[model samples]
Target: MAIIHYFAPMMKMRIFGLVFLGMAAACYNPPRNCNDFKEGEFRFTTVVGENEQTTTFIRRKSIEIDYYQEKADTSSIRWINDCEYVVKKINPKTPAEEKSIHMKILSTTDSSYTFEYGLVGSSKKSRGTAFKVN
Candidate 1:
């Protein structure tokens, strides 16, 4: 009986803490203005090996053109929704390039959006940020 008395307050405190955390999580929402990024010129930079590489892309309603390493690649954009799309290269040079990429806009700020992308049928995913240029 004494041990139960000693631990009862601790158990109550834990339950209160958990309830507070759950309420906070339920009230939180990240800002996502995915429609604003639907059509625009954007820049994405990533590190490759020991060098920083940048890719610039222009997105229209159904197409996207990417310029990287002095080369331009065109891809068709099939929007699953305002925040999700699949990109397929128009003329893929390799088998890997022929695979379409699934992209999802995770969150956004005034001029940039964070996205997660991966191959259409793959479980692996990667994240990147793209800043709008126009």
Candidate 2:
């Protein structure tokens, strides 16, 4: 009985500690290898939620974003690295659906990559991945 009381709390604490470390690691973003990603003018298609749209990205120091609809709504995103970036809508007229996008390049081989993206705000969460065509 006493042994159960003693070991249970200690085991629980250790498990909780590991869970925290895993969460912290996921949030860490540094630099990426430049040569690994397609670093030029890119045009691609994106499907977010149920809405289908197209994006044309021009990469310089950051990604210059343009949306194709009736007209082009342009935005700018700063890159943490070649594969990670922080994006916020440039000038939102009516508070669109999402304010910010967290972009991640999942895997890279030769010409294409798998990407995962999410909204910055936790209240509005989104997750999607796409491939690059060059």
lDDT of 2 at 42: 60
| Cα lDDT for residue 109, candidate 1 | 98
Please give, for residues 1-134, the per-residue lDDT of candidate 1 as tens digits: 99999999999999999999999999897899999999999999999899999999999999999999999999999999889999999999999999999999999999999999999999999999999999
> How many residue pairs clash per model?
0, 0
The candidate that wins on TM-score is 1
lDDT at 9 for candidate 2?
96
TM, every model = 0.86, 0.54
Query: Candidate 1 regions off by >4 Å?
Result: 1-14
Q: Residue by residue across 1-134, what tens digits does model 2's lDDT show?
A: 99999999999999999999999999886444444553555656767789887765655455455546646666677787767887776777767534777777766545455566777755544444333445
lDDT of 1 at 105: 98
Candidate 2 runs further than 4 Å off = 1-38, 47-53, 123-134
Candidate 2: which pairs clash?
none
